[model samples]
Target: MIGTSEIILIFGIVIFWIPVILLIYLSIRYLINRSKKVHEEKTALDILKERYAKGEITKEEFEEIKKTLDSA
Candidate 1:
């Protein structure tokens, strides 16, 4: 029952929406990755602070480690 025009229209719609769908997917993925990185950085910083508080590392050592962590 479908004509050539109908087939072309369906293909056209799909082509138009494919990139939009991909873009949305990529954006969500990027945001999730960014948030995860931030969480990991915070966790590392917390652990470093805890170590410093516990006297496991010297002040200079803590400062060096913190600088490395923040840079990453």
Candidate 2:
């Protein structure tokens, strides 16, 4: 049978590593989310610029739309 001190040692090891594991997981998730956001922003800006270049929107309208997208 394990003594009290042995159980405490095991618990301490687990407690110490739990936060490390959680931090790694959170960092990965944050990176993935940030990448998706950047890609979407780039795509939206590209579309807006394309429309402006094609003369679908006036220069003033393009500027306003660009400002809105950038604010997002």
Candidate 3:
């Protein structure tokens, strides 16, 4: 048979672990979101560079756009 004190101890342990589990889940989610944002920015920069190389943008336009991306 379990005493009341032992039952309380068990409950405390469970409660203590819940926040740890939530922190790990949130950390993973944050990393994934950060990685996705970085990938999006890299892709945008690559596209801009390609367009400039193809002469789709004039030198002044490319410089202005590149400056904007750099600032971001």
| Best candidate, TM-score | 2
Q: Give the alpha carbon lDDT tens digit for every residue of 1-72 in model 2.
A: 999999999999999999999999999999999999987765888899899999999999999999998999
- C-alpha lDDT values of all predictions: 0.96, 0.94, 0.92
Q: What is residue 70's positional error in candidate 3, in angstroms?
A: 13
- What lDDT score goes with residue 27 in model 3? 100
Clashing pairs in 2: none
Compared with the true structure, what per-residue lDDT tens digits does model 3 show for residues 1-72?
999999999999999999999999999999999999987775667889899899999989988988998999
Best by lDDT: 1
Worst 10 residues of 1 by lDDT: 37-46
Model 3: how far is 25 from its true place, Å?
0.8
Runs of candidate 3 with Cα error greater than 4 angstroms are 42-72
Local accuracy of candidate 1 as per-residue lDDT tens digits, 36-60: 9987765888899999999999999
Q: What is the lDDT of candidate 3?
A: 0.92
Looking at model 1, the pairs that clash are none
